[model samples]
Target: MNNPTNSKNPADVVVIGAGIVGLAHAALAVGRGLTVTVIERDDRAVGASIRNFGHCCITAQSGELYDLAQSSRGHWLYFAERAGFWASEAGALVVARNDVELQVLRELAGRREAGQVTVLRAEETTAQLRTAQGTPDPAILGGAMLRDDLRVDPRTTVGKLAAWLQEQGVDFLWRTSAVGFDDGAVHTNRGTVYGRRTIVCVGHDVDYLFPSVSKEHIVERCTLQMSRAAQPAGLTLGPAVLTATSMLRYDAFTEMPSAIELSRTVDSGLQAIGANVMFTQHPDGSLILGDSHTYQHTAAPFLSENTTDLINAEIGALLGMPLEITERWQGIYASSPNGPLLVKEVQPGVTAVSVTSGVGMTVSFGLAERTLNSLFESVHSHRGSS
Candidate 1:
């Protein structure tokens, strides 16, 4: 909904890509009184940023990413209020259906500082789920209630944020492609746009402008298949839900002692295919569910019915009921075996950054703030020397 004609003026920062990363950079720059122009190839953001579960899985993150997620949590709330979007502080309910999974939760709880995580007995978890109109499988041994996560409706969050940014005076150039960049300008299909600094947050399309860096980092595309179901009548899923399979996938839980045993208990096929089940509810009472990860240099744009069926079966076991699926889709994000994120100076006064770990919505705000601060400091230092 932003007017492209209004974006002809030069800006302090020109951000390429209108996904969450670019939008985060523009928001932070504008907040610091810098004029910003954002360019997107699509008329609107239609990428991993919008296709995700809108989960800021704070409790499951580890190391630097964990800190980033914690810092980003406040921004999620702040933007939700300013952008007029739905944001929930509802954490995560990680259900453990067996003793091995319960042991993993117990080990994780023991390692963390007090009060950060709470382990609930099977009866307690069932009672809480029942209160929320969820029917937990009787086989569920217990659950870990991670109190720090957040969720938003992915389908609408970015659109709302982009609109809010326009209201804050940020310019957007829709359907524009950046072919290249120089010292302080971007060469696009429209024309050359000048800026004091340039930041590229193009998500998985790394080869578009920086093929060398993308190749050097071994960046590949990771595809995931997801589905949504009409919420059962009168049911409110109080928190984002995860099954025991999630324990083997999230580093925070996987690094724990009992995780090995839990992993051994899981099906080898699911493990080999990197399938994990997660559920987050939207305000409209629809449950967004997913997903299986498949990585390659170029991901095939096909959604496997087998993967969908596996996801449904896994979640059905936890929910104790069959869900009426309403929609199905697939999303692709950048992935790297080298690191969780890629941040490098692709050229003078231009930085290229990508969230290769599918945590863009989780850590983008904090990461952007840090990136902008460092960039501004470098520019100031150069000016002082000159």
Candidate 2:
């Protein structure tokens, strides 16, 4: 690979992936007084970090993650403002379609601290979005939407973050692929690049990096299809969205479906995995719509016509507007056990991580500190045995 950004001077640390997780690690590592260089195969930001809906999901996360996401949102807001990135904290609606689902949602709200989650009725739900699919089943519900999920333009945010990282004195090695590792040298397309410490946040590429660890840490590249449409002038809503499944999927929503409905949702082919619908809008007068999930082994094809149409059908039915189809794309995210989107190790002075998982945008800020602490903290200790 032609190394567009290379240096004769070796770095104190070489980050293997330039995705959000890797960028987060690099930024924090540099801040910790370590000379960091980020290497990537892509010259621009177009992977999961720039592909997904760019949701900073607060309600859909678990205990420590929720707090982490909340803090991440704060940093994103600050950086986004300075960089002129399109960002909004327009809260999300985790709708329930049936009585059973509503029962589940009610349970969720009751368990959380008041205002942590607010349960909305069909009328209130419709009142908020001003858009409805079918009438809520008395037994199933219209669904409950959270008042906190924030949406940012992925392309805008990541592109700017990468630029800012450069300004902050962090080095980048774009269009450079890592071949492998042995001893202390990191094998790359541009040949071995030696460093004092290293980190890898390769998303789906993890399978190739460590085949044995792949089984223990399975990364299913969830292909999500998304669409964009031009919105009529003066038409707008503030928050990103969650399907009805989110109410059940997220820990924040304690009230999930009843035993009966939950069983039905889990069993039915379409509803089984809780694939409902989600909604969000962009400031450029275009709406970011999407997405369906499918797992693939490697190099998963993102642009799919069939699934894109399927997702759009759901959107049209629910939105009831003549949406002008504008952009179409697919995203690959990493999913694994225990739901940590980030993992870091400093052994041999190397840190390999991935957050191609859904919460990359929301969780990156919070995970940055942990990623470094796991690696640099031990090495940077000044208190040596006297």
Top candidate (TM-score): 1
Model 1 scores a TM of: 0.93
Model 1 stretches with alpha carbons more than 4 Å out: 1-9, 131-135, 378-386
lDDT of each: 0.84, 0.66
RMSD of each: 4.3, 5.1
Per-residue lDDT tens digits of candidate 1, residues 185-224? 8888877778888999999997667889999988999999
Candidate 1 total steric clashes: 0
Error of 2 at 64 (Å): 4.7
Give per-model TM-scores.
0.93, 0.83
Superposition error at 244 for model 1 (Å): 2.0
